[model samples]
Target: MFFVILLAQTVIGQKITGTVYDDTKTPLPGANVYVKGTSKGTTTDFDGKYEIEIDAKHQVLVFSFIGYKTKEVKVKGKTIVNVTLEQDSATLDEVVVVGMAESRMMKREHVVGYSIARIPQNTESYAAIKENDFKDVIKNPLSTFSVDVDKASYSNVRRYINNGGLPPADAVRIEEMINYFNYDYKAPKDDAPFSINTELSACPWNKDNLLLHVGLQGKKIPMDDLPPSNIVFLLDVSGSMNSPNKLPLLKSSLKLLLESLRPKDRVAIVVYAGSSGLVLPSTSCKDKKTIIEALEGLSAGGSTAGGEGLKLAYKIANENFIKKGNNRIVMATDGDFNVGLSSNSEMERLITEEREKGIAISVLGFGMGNYKDDKMEIIADKGNGNYAYIDNLLEARKVLVSEFGGTMYTIAKDVKFQLEFNPVHVSKYRLVGYENRLLNEEDFEDDTKDAGEIGAGHTVTALYEIIPSKNNSDKENRLRYQTSELTSQALESNDLITLKLRYKKPEKNKSLLIEQSVQNKPVAFTETSDNYRFSASVAEFGMLLRDSKYLGTATWKSAYMLAKDAKGSDEEGYRGEMIRLIKSAELLSSNKQE
Candidate 1:
């Protein structure tokens, strides 16, 4: 009898089991079940079933899932403790507001005397954008701007279209839309990090203007040859992220990335809600199971302390920094920072400071309605990193798995492009996009001026619309007091523009310059390569969505046909998807017009 009692006591201390459910009695798969105050935990399986070993000192079991209030039950010497969590009212209200906004059933700003916190959650979030205007080539000959490789806007807009609505104009970033699709540019040949390709063709939208397409292709590095990585996952577990599409999806997305990590790589996890804390210290990729367990145990709650989380994540990344290796922080959030150090400026300053220590920051935006895209974009821009939106598992795979090297490893930094249009060939010109990335003409040659970074196997594209000098109908009159004249050499030259590219090695501060002069070689729009046609289609689509004043004769049907024709060897189906989206948008726009 004494031996039997001792064995039973040992079994009781060794294990505890439970099932977790939401208010509607639906099984909450992926819900976290753990002993309070301890790292020992396990996630509920598909059936909401979980079994975790318990230490004798740990007398309480905690059950948690995003969007549901967390529940803690004292063991009290019980063998089983099933839990049902109530829906968090604040989160439900936010979801309701998002639904109303999507349906256009109500205006969030109609509530009188409402504070920001109390304002209807229906207010969709987007950054303000002012489109670029035409520049007189004689007066403003130099067009300089940083390269932007971020593709968040494309996926975010897709999410809206897929949900049966057109995206807000401010959400449609033309540069990002053009960059999302891969182009068939030539690969780098030598020690240079990337190769540049240029093509000039007649503009499809505006018959009077010509389009100049510039492309950059980064050298590809084999996965086996990639350096060891030191990555810290800065995850937001605040109340705002307590939704099915936020925290839960984020965990699943990170798991896909974990499958790509090698034994030489290391990972750390830092989670923040009302406060910040390190859940897992730096661990080798070989111990993936342990790392995954830590991720599965995380549950969203409380307010967002994003600044605090950023600091802690950067500290962890710095501590485990590897020389000549990929050191970065992958931040997954909805961009809602309501508590401690929540201001955009403060967050930007923190990211900028940390990036100087050689740790890049890649932001993965999730959720909608309350998303702070402006904040996310700025953080990634200043942090020497890239930004992508993960709307679903496929997009997560695209960013975290398929484009691993290009998304995480940097080969070149501070990349800027400057173009000088010759008055002899071009009368007026305007950059198609990159309004926010514009830089001072002098900043192009300044090595200290920060710009965008290029990763392995990455590609950057830019477009310009130019009016020929022969077509002088829109030309401005010469200054009344001063006579503008071109040199004999300029008059004899056939060069339309001189393109100059400046970039620095990932580890060096010195910049390298590459210059190429484009002559008056114009091809018909239909005779252009698939790269030119596809990119032009994307830009035209963006203009139509924004209802830009500059969009002359651009129609959805034309953009759709162009995209379908130029969908070349799209192994990833991204180009095909764009065609379908264009069709959907056309229908939506037509319905609205009716």
Candidate 2:
């Protein structure tokens, strides 16, 4: 009887295990195997085998893997639980950040006809998108210009919430750039150029904002062992970041980032408040438990000390810089660098030095109310990084994970656009957007001129409204030479305008050029292509919102009505969101003029 009891105990103590594989039968390493949320999880070994302790405690086991989605299975009182992950088709929204601004949707086109007024040439400016023709309002507003979707490549997108569970106004937000499409982008199958397809049909609401049909085909990143990444989490625990929307949302955002990291990566935490200090030394990705614990203990307090924080972060990053691995300092804050490096020049100098050492920076702006937009711009620009504002969780997912390549990896830096107008077919022309990014025509050919960067798969779009010289009607709008003074005889006869683009390949100091021309044709604004229609909507929206003081007779209602009429079905639902946002804005302000 004792021997029988011993045998039974031995049998009960036996471990049950199996390997987890994908549909391809490939061993899935690093898969998470957990029994609910008991803080107990065992990762599969290199061979994907698990010898986890099994008692009467667990009836269902959960399996999760990144990119492949997640799953759960009931053991049925048995011992083994094998999981197969399916790709999550319902992806999150993308965050689209270009240069130093939020890419927004626009609704009007500024057609340049010969203006009888002193300004001449129909101008597309803050005057075009203003809300109330108010000088200050027109010059600066919440958002400006249409996102470069049709032109640029997908960079990132935020996670999706059911039925619009977006983050609060003060939280950080990002959108998933590729959720709108399905890309099987494989490295050029045979080194031929890979191309994505995009098309447009008539727009529903606004016939002008035509429906967009895009199918992108691109070369894929060949599967290879990625260089080990060394990441420094430079967090802002400043007093201004104490709001629930700031610190709490920031924590959740970083947690999402932690989830995306692989076991081979290393992360170090450096935090700043009244001053800066290292919270956690660099640790392997496998040490997720300790890292998460440190993250949870973080609290927001004390005045901001950005200078101190940056120095310490650089020190830690330099200590662990990888020869070829990614070394990035992700700074999260509202760009309030007071108490230290308060001046832009000093901060610029420090960041410049760090950039020279190949330590890149990515600035994530959090919180509002006391948000410092100008500071964020300066840091991101000089830090060799870009700036993004997270108004919600969606933005977090976009920035951290979606289209990670484009946002984190640049294709070309210092891209500049220059257009030389011809006096022949076109009497005059007006550039529709990019008031801030404008460069002198001479800079278009100069590689040394500081310009914008473009990421892999990024497409850039710029538009101009032309006035055909044949139409005597526009003769009034052209900025007539006060006395035909400046132009030499040779300069007086050039077609409509020549658009020039200059850019440098990533890691290359030299520049390349591309040019296209437009003849002043009978093409009226209404007669332009779908691309023009969509672009017009963008320009008009900017003008109405800025409340340009130059808006003599135009009003918000008219602009909104035009946009509503031009907006299409918007199967993606972006158009619908626009209607809601605009309507809400109209209602929020006291100046409601029907």
Candidate 3:
């Protein structure tokens, strides 16, 4: 049949192949691969093998992917073109959360380490404990929150946290990671081969918190700067969203999301109360009168049929889907799928299938008291989407309006980080966080495995604490059958940790690599680094709160202290809010105990 011949040709195009890896040697699951200059791509299976046939018209094939580098190969249709993707040192442009105006030195001009005091450094006595130790910590995607704080041998964790020794009085803080940035970075406009911009801020919630903002603009690629977006605001007006912070705050936050859409982009307001019903169908983005009217009509009262609502929203999106345009479904809810196909797994399945059909999901979580943090995180992770918590309206703008590229576009998918310690330079190392994103060492080289995605301008940061072999005075565990023994001549740790990142472009399947390094001695604590400091602070805060086994952290008090001390030239109000959050968390913890 004519159809059969077409299918054969489709399968016979030039074949290009490659392997992928995280900083560690693990096969990343669900990574995507495809040829450049074409719309054909396939995802890496569990084993990470991919082969797609493309025309050999231009023997040279361009391979691109998210998180990794973009490689161009001049192949007379080579069957195997193995590639190793590196990490991207540049970060995306987004609203950098610096502590708020509370600590804002408006009149004072900014300098690298201005208004910063040197850290009083003294090693903790407990640091003299047995060299290699292990501890426990719970982890998952999106975020980590736990009720039980202590259940493992922190061992030197306290020593790791304490500046000298004793309980921590400061929380190693970074507000930018906590807040996410406000703008998506754009490539450079000049012809100067390379360009870069960096930002720094203190925590907004805790006095000790600090936020760093890093931006890297690549060579400008001419593309249409489309007007706003045709966003469909879908609200779940169900009984489960009855909490004061849930539905009520959600209403207020939705108002902020609305502000981002312009009249040029079409927007429709949809809400699901007792059953699925269209409060307002598709409308113009500029028609605020119609939009607000529909939004105000929404209220909480009735069982939720989330499935029905989602189906209807997708219908509307498909009908109004913009080809080569940002057509998105913004879902705001507590993630209670009680009414229909409500299970987290069910929602994930539905969203996964929908992503291939071209509709994207953006989840904005509201409230605190009874919010489903885990459920929310999963839905976002599996849905090929971005998820954020909008505790207030200001946060709503940050997620909905501010950073669009880092938020909406998919630059790479199934991003996994892995690293291999050179026997000559390293002994033992511990990845700071990402307990959930870990992969087997073998998986790193497997290009077909699925991992995480990097947004258009987003920056992924992972830190590891390593102990040098020379510094380690412990017995070595030797491997059997090998001529070499660990005791013979163990290599020391690298003075710097080599950072490796891999990714696939939204339209292509083949992956590329980018790499950079971080010195173990670390930059001066008081020095200015908008991106690293903010990300570092977030990692510290997450560890402390979750009671991490290897945490260099503690209670809210110390967390706040670290953020405060790290406060640098924080033009953004992120750091200020971190201070407030510390105070709020302290109070919340107090009230819970009572």
User: lDDT winner among the candidates?
Assistant: 1
Over the full model, what C-alpha lDDT does candidate 1 score relative to the true structure?
Answer: 0.83
TM-score of each: 0.80, 0.59, 0.59
Model 2 accuracy (lDDT, Cα): 0.52
In the range 323-406, model 2's lDDT, one tens digit per residue, is 766677888887666698788788888887887676778777765446665566557666656666675555566566654544
Compared with the true structure, all predictions reach lDDT values of 0.83, 0.52, 0.49
Candidate number that wins on lDDT, 2 or 3: 2
Worst 10 residues of 3 by lDDT: 143-152
Native-to-model Cα distance after best TM-score fit, residue 406 in candidate 1, in Å? 0.7
Q: Pairing residues by index, what is the TM-score of model 1?
A: 0.80
Candidate 1 lDDT, tens digit per residue, 454-487?
Answer: 9899999999998888843434447898756777
Worst 10 residues of 1 by lDDT: 91-100
Candidate 2, position 196, lDDT: 30
Query: Rank by lDDT, descending?
Result: 1, 2, 3
104 Cα displacement, candidate 1 (Å): 21
The total of clashing pairs for model 2 equals: 82
